[model samples]
Target: MNLLINVFLLSVFFPYITVIKSLDTQPTALFLGTVLFLIYFKAEKKQNRYIFYILILSILSIFLFEKSNIMMSIRGILNYWSLGIISYVSYELFKRNKIKNSIIKRSINAWFILGFIQTFYSKYFFKFLIVGMRTSDDRGVTSFATEPTFYGIICIFFGILVIENFKKNDCILFFSNLLIQILFFSKSSMVVLFLLIWISLYILKNISLKAILFSSTSLVSFHFIIINFLKDTRVYKLYIKSSDLKKLFFEDHSLNMRLSHIFYSLKGALQNFLLPNGLTQWIEYVRIETLQKTYFHTLTPTTSARIMSGFGGIIYESGLIGIIFIGIIFFCLKKGLKNKEIAIFIIIISFSAIQPSFPLNGFILGMSIFNLEKRRIHKNEKIKSNDCCRN
Candidate 1:
C-alpha cells in the first residue's frame, strides 16, 4: 500500500527533474533527492529476484567494455535506477496484492478531474496547476504528466488497473480518459487508439485463427490503400501539417539520421562489443564532442551527424550485449507470457519506437507488463488449485 501510494502520488508528482545544460548534449535527469526519504528505507518484498539480476547484468556491462566518459555512463545507470528500479519495485508490490476498489475509484476520479482540466489546455494552464495535477503544454495536454506521451502511458496504465478491478464506474472513467486523450492530439494518441481497440476486442471471446489472420491482413491492406488514396488526393497535406505528424501520417525524415546513430553505435560496439556506451544519446553526442575538442585546432571535423531514434539508441548505448541482456529478461518471462503478450509488446514498442530516448521508459513499461502477466498467472493458479480441491 505504501509502495502503491509512493508510485501513484510521490514518484509521479515529484519527479523533480534536474536539467544539465551542455552543448554536447543536455542530460535531463529525474531524481527525487528528498521527497520519498521517509519511505526510502522500507524494503519492498520481491517474489522473484529478476530485477536484481538485471541490475547486476547492467553493472557488468561497464567492466566488459570500454567505459568512455564513465561519469556520464554512471548517470545513464542512475537513470535506469530512477525510472526502471522504481517502476519494477512498485509493480512487485502490486503483483501479489489486491488493489483496493476504493483506491482504484479515487485514482480514476482524480484522472477524470485532471482530464477535464486538460480540455482548457495551454502553456498558461500548464504553468499553474489548477489542481494538484498538471494541465497543458505547448506540445499538447500533459495533465499531471510532464509530457503528452508520458500522460497517455499513465492513462493506459490506469485503464488497465480499472479493468482489472472490474468496476463499472471505473470502466466509464477509462473510456472518458480515452476521449480526453483524443482531445489532446498527442503523439501518444496512437497508443491510446490501439489499446482502446484491442481491449474492446476482449468482448469477442475465442477468435478463430483464420478470422484473426484475415482481420489483420485486411487492416494492413486497408491502411496502405488509404495512405495511397490520401497521397492521390493530398487530403493528408491539409490535415496533418506538422513535420513530425507528417512522419506518422505520410513521410519521415531521411533514414540517414537513424542510420548514422545505429552505424556509429554498432562501430562503438565493435570496439568493445561485449558492452557498449551506456544508453544515453548524450553519450553519443558527448563522444563526438570530445573528438571535436581534440581536433579543434585542425580545420577538420571529427564526427558524423547523428539523430536520435529509439532502436538506434539501444544499439548505441547497450550494444549487442545489452540487447541480449534485455532479451534474456523477456525470454525468462515466458513462464507467464499470456495470449495477448504479442499485442501488449506491439503497443508498448509502437509508442517507444517513434521517440528520441525510450530505453528508460521502455524498461519501466516492459516491467509493468511483466508484473501484470505474473499476477494474472498467479490468479489463474489460485483458481485452478481451488477447483481441484473442491472436486
Candidate 2:
C-alpha cells in the first residue's frame, strides 16, 4: 500500500503523462492508482460504503438524462467521482503509512523540481501559453499543465509543504521558494497570499507582540508600495484608466472575463438548482444574456472559453446536491481539526473562493495535517491526566 501510494503521488506530481488533453476526460491518476492499490490492498469497505454508493448513483444520473453527451459524462466522472474517491484513498493511505516528516519534505522537493522542469519544457518545447498572457510575458511557464493557473496551484501546494517544514527557518529555501513563483509567472494570487499567511502565523506563534506589530506595519506600507507600483505596470493599465468602482471591476478585460463567468454561474445555479449542467455542458436551456459569452470552447484545456466559475461552477455543474456532498465531506474533515488547524483553513479558503475549482489538494493536505495534530493533542492530554493521577 505504501509503495503504491508513492507511485500514485508521483503520477499526480510528476510530468510523465505526455497527453495533457486526455486528462480532461480520463482519470489519469485516479484510474491508475485504483488499479495498483486494488492489486495489493483490499479497498476500505466499512466507512466509505454510503458515500461511495451515493457518488456512484449521482454519476449514473447524468447518463439517464443525456446519453448523447458522453464527453460531459466523462468530465463529470473524472472531476467529481474519480477525484473524490482517489483523494480519499490518498488520505487514507497516507494515514495508514503514518505520514512522516521525511515523506513531506521529499514530496515538496519533487514538486519543486518537477514544476521547474515542466515550466521550461512548456515554454520552449510545448509552447503551452494562456490567452491573456503572451510568449514574452515571462509568466508563460505552465510546466506539464496546459495552463499557468493550475501550475500556480501546484506550486502553492508545495508552498504549504514548505510551511509544514518552515519551523526550521531556512533563509535560503525561503528565498528560493519565492524565486520559483516569479519564474512561473503564475496568475493565481495564492502564491503571495499563502506565503503571507505562513509568515503571519509563524510570527504569531514564535515571535513577540512587538515583532507582530512591526510585521503588520511593514505589510500595510507594502500595500501602499504595491498600489503605486502596480498602477504603472501593464497588468493594471486598465485599472489606472477606470476610476469608477463598477467600471474597474466590470470592464477590465482580465478581471471581467472571470467576473462574468461567476455571475453566469450564480444565475444558472438559481435557475437550475436541481439539474445544473456539468462541465462542458452548453445546453440551450440556460437563458441568460451574460451566459452567452461563456459559450466559446476549443478542445484545449487552457482555452479562454473553459468553464471557470470559481465556487459558482460547483453550483452550476452539479447544482445544490453536489454542494451538499462537498459540504458533508468538509464538515466531516472539520470535526477533528484543532484551533490552529482552523486558522490555517481560513487562509486556504480565502484563495479558494476565487480559484476555478475547489482546491482539493490543499483540502487533503490540511485535513491530514489537522488529523495528526488532533492525535498529538489527544496524546498530550492523556499524558497530563496520567501525571495528575500519579501525583
- Candidate achieving the largest TM-score: 2
Distance from true location, Cα of 213 in model 1, Å: 13
Whole-model alpha-carbon lDDT for candidate 1:
0.45
Error of 2 at 311 (Å): 3.3
Over the stretch 51-88, how does candidate 1's per-residue lDDT look in tens digits? 55554654464453336555655655553344344445
How many steric overlaps are in each model, in order? 0, 2
Whole-model lDDT, model 2: 0.49
Instruction: Point out where model 2 deviates above 4 Å.
Output: 1-3, 15-17, 20-26, 36-45, 48-65, 98-107, 110-122, 125-140, 164-245, 273-287, 291-306, 336-391
List per-prediction Cα lDDT, in the order shown. 0.45, 0.49
Worst 10-residue lDDT window, candidate 1: 21-30
| Candidate 2 accuracy as TM-score | 0.67
Model 2 per-residue lDDT tens digits across residues 1-391: 5576565665555422344544422245666656754643365554443234434634543542456666665554555545454545555555465445565556555545545664555454433322222233423455444455555556655554455434556524753664455333443333444545656765766588887886787567545643664343333444345568565665445555555555666676677655757665534433334344443221122333444544466667767765675554455444534334434554344324333223334235334444654576799999999999999
- Model 1, residue 118: distance off in Å is 3.8
